[model samples]
Target chain A: MEKKDKIYEGKAKIAKLEVDESPNTAQKYGIMSIPTIVLFKDGESVWQGVGVQQKQTIEAELNKVAS
Target chain B: MSAQYKVVILGTGPAGLTAAIYLARASVVPIVFSGPQPGGQLSTTTEVGNYPGFVEDIQGPELMDRMRKQAERYGTKFIEEEITSVDFSKKPFSLKTSTQTVTADSVIIATGASAKWLGLDSEQKLRGKGVSACATCDGFFFKDKDVVVVGGGDTAMEEATFLTKFAKKVTIIARGSEGNLKASKFMEERAIKDSKISFIYSSEVIEVIGDNKVDSVKIKNNENGKEKVIKIDGLFIAIGHKPNTDFLGDQLELDKGYIKVKDNTKTSVPGIFTGGDVHDWRYRQAVTAAGFGCMAALDVERYLEGIF
Candidate 1:
């Protein structure tokens, strides 16, 4: 679904699953904010964060899920 | 000499760029490391007024863009990378960034401070929509609208007082009773005297509520387990700011989590100067940061004169 919804596929490392125009996906995930990034390794959320976070934070989270 | 610059300025905010402009014009050939957020705090802001030059006003990012271009025009070399560590113990200070390590004869610490937030999920969601950390920067957008400010310190008092000019009603959410307020006598008295300003003692903002924009805030009493929702048009977090000196690794002196400077921008160690929000706690304005940047540049030039 994110493959169809994502405007651009900048990096192929991680897939972006967004439900911007539709609120159903957000409601399902209890997401109430924009720029909320969630890391999923095996169809399950491993880590998540909100707001405009630093690159270090995102990289650390990605490393955690990857490990 | 294995390639050492005359000076290296950390950060790309108003202060860093201004220093670069002065340094480049003087032919000192300064290198600037623009940290994670290039253009710093100003990039997050929408409009910039009281910056002195632009009478018609300009966007915050736009103002920073012009400053960066001006610095570049003067031959200021820019690096969009983060400095992971710095070794200022010896001459020709070594800096390790995300990409490469560089050395500079003199180093200017222009890394600006960041505003503290409540770390609330809803608060994070509504940022730039109706929630802001700076009253002076975003209060104009809340004209004649009800707003709330968080914090019990002098910063909160100052923000609440400043918001009165634009907000119809300003509510201060202090963590404890009024007696627990950390504000000074004059600042507290100023807010207390303001007709538009009100207080909610022994309270904390638990959650922010809104769909498109902020329409209300949920606050909880510290003593009791009761929560109340108040309609609000805007929210300001006046909990103060933390300086960007983490990478210094206890090398430079810090006073209350901020880099301490004397005679404007001179740090405790010679040839190592600090400018912008990293040192200026009284007025964190862009203009003042630029002034500090100018001072740091001249100080570095004079310091380099004795070295080479």
Candidate 2:
């Protein structure tokens, strides 16, 4: 669902997970909330959140990943 | 050296975004890290009527989206990264991501707390459909309806008391005996005084029986080993809330797991401000969080001016 949102652009990718994807993965990540976004670079996580954020801030983080 | 910002605000909830709006308006240009819960607790909610200024109630996610847009319009930079770690011991506080380590003159922690819920599959299935965590936000819609509240704490007692205004009958489902209520004497007394409320002691909600919305709850009596199905229109989970600050444990001062704030929104450490549920255990409303966010940003601006 996130992949289709077009929220992620320019070298950034988004993925969605079902509630049962992993054993208490959401709980482990302290995600007692929904619609969380976890940003990754080279298979490493960079950021995560529960809702939409501004574009420039995301770009700044993406720029760091690109470099 | 990596780039450094004047301020870095964490959590894009109402508190964080409100702070960002203030700082941005002041030309502080805060870089707001949206955290794991960007729009905060409001996003998971279905409708928000208590937020004020909205003559007609609006969807929770839509309200947050509007706030996010408002903050962005004021030049607040929003980041989608989850800050994995931080080193507050340094002058220019260092925050590390999987991709880079960035520094900021000031940091505001608005990572809000999350309400705990029963791990029942049926409960999860019916969330926002008829099952909710906040009674204050959703109770009005359940007017003259039967509702079930889970937990034995002050929050549960309070929620039960609040729900009575709307609910025809309020059932308090405690995992333990009625004597095991963790609520304060005043709250417990208040719950006991409510004629519309009934106690379901030593019981747990095995399942919320409903197709798409909560219509009943299957309960198990822990002591008597008895089972019963009670009809209800809604389920309110008031177990408690855990702040999203385990990542910052002991790195800053905390009062009973909640981040401790000094003057206004100032934390124990200088240049590190906190707001919302992460720093507040009481008054965890959207308006209060926004107020704290504004204070934190103003304090951050003062701290930044002294250094920058």
Candidate 3:
């Protein structure tokens, strides 16, 4: 809830991919739009959020999948 | 518990950032809430040649990012959070983000407007693949390809005209009769004179057919109930936009969903001000929005001075 909360940060590994350079990865993920966030669990995408999303929404999604 | 601030500016558009620049320079130290789209609608745009000062041209996102940095250098604190709701009746107005609550003495609402979608399932699925709401942002991708522009308003005409520079052919799909267009004479004539632009009257895109990209669209006639499919490379929905004011509830008066402003930037609520596309449907340019932001900041400064 606070900015200093590192609980969720410690549980997940975040990776940023450049869709331009990694065309294969982008294509594999079927990423047609910019700023597409895909949550992967065990090398599979469980949830995907497109465009701008609220922090709480992402946190809730993360909580659902992480559990 | 909530963080208290003297001034809180919503949105990170040209308006909000410009307000921050002014307020921060005046030692107001306003906290800016960067809504979902940090750079606002302009971020989705491509080339911005008419914002003034720039000799050549700047990309939409680049201009907004520079504005944000300028505001940041001047002591403006930016939070990448959107206010979900607000209560303006209280002395220090309360606002809620998805996570926590915050309070501000004065508020500037520059949340701007968002494009209206067709709400079709297929349209949602192929948004970025080949369907787009912004022709300026996605027109280049349809170069040498055919595309369809939906709507009968000036925005629809403008988008079709702009697309003609890139797309091989641009088709206008109007759900109303041919004579029942909402576009002004100037805009209609400009679009009509374009050789690459054509119109399909009294028709609607029932479905956007595609797999990964837009292949074609299923259009149905409103009069005779005739259905037809036209192959296209991209679909542009230019139906128009709705202001982002759901969070305000009944705290402020709104005109057709846009916040109503009086005395330049002051809204119906005394301490609550507005700028940009949220209050201005006409002349929704970045420069004009920034000007509004500047005015709102000045008004807020005067209002705060009187109180303090």
Residue B233 displacement (Å), model 3 = 5.4
Q: lDDT at B213 for candidate 2?
A: 68
lDDT of each: 0.83, 0.81, 0.90
What TM-score is obtained by chain A of candidate 3?
0.84
TM-scores for all candidates: the values are 0.67, 0.64, 0.85
Q: Record all residue pairs in model 3 with backbone atoms less than 3 Å apart, i.e. clashing.
A: none
Residue-wise lDDT of candidate 1 within B1-308, one digit each (tens)?
A: 34578899999899999999999999988899888778988886666778998888799889999999999999999876788898888877888876578898899999999889999999988886788887766676676889999999998998898889889999999996977788888898999999999999999999999986789999999898799999998899988788888888888889987898887778888889989998888799999999999999989998889842
Alpha-carbon shift of residue B116 in model 1 (angstroms): 1.9
- Candidate 1, B-chain TM: 0.74
Better of 2 and 3 by TM-score: 3
TM-scores for chain B, listed for all candidates: 0.74, 0.72, 0.90
The complex in candidate 3 yields a DockQ of 0.34
Candidate 2 C-alpha lDDT tens digits along B1-308: 98799999889788998999999999989898777656888876666889989999988889899989988998988877778788999878999876778899889999899888888999887776568888865676576789989999988998999899889999899887767778888998889889999898989889889885678999999988899999888899999998888778578998888998877888888889998889888899998999999988888888877842
Off by over 4 Å in 2: A1-67, B117-149, B153-172, B176-199, B204-237
How many angstroms is the interface RMSD of candidate 3?
A: 2.9
> How many steric overlaps does candidate 3 have?
0
